[model samples]
Target: MANFASTADLEEKKITFEEIAENVYAYTAEGDPNSGVIVGDDGVLVMDAQATPIQAQKLIDCIRGVTDKPIKYVVLSHYHAVRVMGASAYGAEAIIASQLTYDNVVERGQQDFDSEVGRFPRLFDQVETVPGLTWPTITFEKKMSLWMGKREVQLLHLGRSHTKGDIVAWIPDCKVCFAGDMVEYGATPYTGDAYLSDWPTTLDNLMALGAEKMIPGRGEALKTADEVKAGVGGTRDFLSDLFETVKKCVADGKDLTATYKETMDIMRPKYGQWVIFDHCMPFDVTRAYQEASGQEHPQIWTADRDREMWLALERDQSAA
Candidate 1:
């Protein structure tokens, strides 16, 4: 059977730290989850902490290289364990997240932490360094603004796409946006906890921001408007096509196994080149199938569920 979810993905990715604007930066790897840095006059605000303390410290090193300012706030783009588990390492005054994200942390934080660690062991190096669950010191319903001296960073929850509480940090003056998992450059969207029907409209809200530069959740930074559009458009197209195909299969009364195989045959040709395509497809199609079959919210994924789903979808079908 295919090595269970990312277990074979052990090679370390090369890290890149690039300046997208005057003081705005993107800390990216080949295809690992990315973090965004906004160095204001007084302090720095980080978007998306890495998977563990050791990983987060690497991003901290990148920030220190450019500026000596204190890291005051760490904003969680969503409540995914891979993105929010490293909040403690920043030593920021306050960790911020949307109300929905906070709720998810309360609801499924430990399950997610356990599930992710089991799936992608390489990303959670020094996993013991993670302290319990990362909680938000401050939470907002829709939007809020944080100021570092004169610079204002607007945090807005655009809509439900990747998760119910996915937010983007928009710097109006610089026209730079730190789009979390809501937009990915060339990485496959992990829709295991996504709202597929609402994703396109959410992308519409993100497009209205008109950010000249953007730091996606993964992949390299988009330094120009055209690149930004392509990043957002690429993500939208992937979700659109995936959901559309899955919905058609469901309407045709295909079983989950049949739908999965059919969807893979179609999507693999187009999205196979994207990072994590194989690792994410089983989970992605399962969630899409659930949503298409009338489930409103995504079922929380546990480590047990991860293995069971992989075996059912990716292993030998006759044996399964």
Candidate 2:
């Protein structure tokens, strides 16, 4: 009963950005989603591979332009296919992530890959180039630290925001955090599988890092502290306002259909232009509606469910 938007309208590919911060570098594209790169004396580490092997290799090409060091590690912030499916292209000795992420990868990685490939066909340009499901070689519980020769990268499971297994890569010396989908710049946060109640506190923990700059999950790299705050604040605000609106409707004993209609009216004006603003709302509201009604964890989205939800939401939205 969530009013969703279709992906049929988006069409274009743009160059990605690479921000050089002393030794660490952030490779961000125009919201095909962003990834990070850190160069150490002996090797290199990449955060979140692109959607397909071909796309990831493009990032590797960009990396080679900056440094010749081998990519020794690839870190996955979560189990989302767009972020992790490109791991094979790195040829790194190890891939690292949180235990929850690893488990989610094991539980739903294939399904996610199929669903995402269908959702964003343009992003996964060379599906055959994908070597298969990208699994993490090393997994951790709460926190993990890596020292690539002299540079230290701390991967912390700050708390669930975008997903239950979300992690952020912290480069202490540079005071920069590569916050994967946990934050986005000028883009709508996808709350389809989110923990809305916990997302803000997770943002609170991220702010405490005092990061001077940040590379969010998508869009441009945040250069100023205010930009960082804006990115996180925007997502938090959208989710908070959305949850409250949905909750009020539910409290009024409205059905899913009525609540979806009411929620859409409340969010469109303030957040209608963020990238994929329309495409992400249905899933966002669907999960928000469930969470507001006491569903602690979001249900996994299957291809059938994706279509069903899309059609149902589209029908309602079109009628209005």
Candidate 3:
């Protein structure tokens, strides 16, 4: 029986640094969080820093293998601890994020750190090295355009998907996009902090960008337009299916335990093998139940809340 989420996922995943576009690359490790690398004429831009300095160093080494250019920018897709906590290691000139993300860091960054570290200890290896909440040196309200020499990187918040602060890095030159946790390819979307009703529209905006190739928050790089569309559609389907099921269950006055069972029974066959599906579902359903019953923003998931919810949902799961 699983004791805690992703704690035993200690074995190193096979790392692949693939150049999907001319100067854009993806550093993927099995289904762990991915960081997109854009090597430009003058410097490099890193999207979604790994969980710790130790974790970030691996990507830095990978970057060194290709170019000796300095990393000039570290972009946070959202405020998740696993993605943003490692920003210090890059030693970049600027760390960039949406203003909402910056605000989220101020609000629940510490609680998120505690919650995430407890859930995925393997990813945050050498956790003590994390400097603290990664505050962006540059914060944008809606859109900001950056230049790494001649390459134009557009940071856009089309709408809220995975979280209120979700953003994507769009490179028009290569028609490649670095989609953060907003769109998971084969992996499950952790919508515990998501706006489920608005998520699909947010994904549509991603589609409208017409990115021929894209790197998702997790899973492998999408090398073709077809694969990019697949990622968006897959994420859309997952969110809609989840909300629809949970909404119906809530309207029928089913309790969370029954909701958990029915939703898992429905989702497991398709998404069971995806990374963190079991871990995310309980949280996902809880948030979905809240939203379906009228809560707007998701309630915070602290370490204490995490344990309580786990026991409430999965305490007897091992015996079953």
Quick one: best lDDT, which candidate?
1
Task: Write one digit per residue (lDDT tens) for candidate 2, span 134-188.
Answer: 8889999988999977767899998998999999999888788999999988888
Per-model TM-score versus the true fold: 0.98, 0.95, 0.97
User: Which should have the higher TM-score, number 2 or number 3?
Assistant: 3
Off-target runs (Cα >4 Å) in candidate 2 are 1-6
What number of clashing residue pairs does each candidate have, in the order they appear? Answer: 0, 2, 0
Worst 10 residues of 3 by lDDT: 1-10
Model 2 CA lDDT for position 56: 88
Over 31-115, each residue of candidate 1 has an lDDT whose tens digit, in order, gives 9999999998889999999999989999999999999999999999999889988889989999999999999998889999999
Clashing pairs in 3: none
lDDT of 3 by residue, 257-313 (tens): 889889999999988988889888999999999999999998888999988988768
lDDT of each: 0.92, 0.85, 0.91
Better of 2 and 3 by lDDT: 3
lDDT for 20 (candidate 3): 88
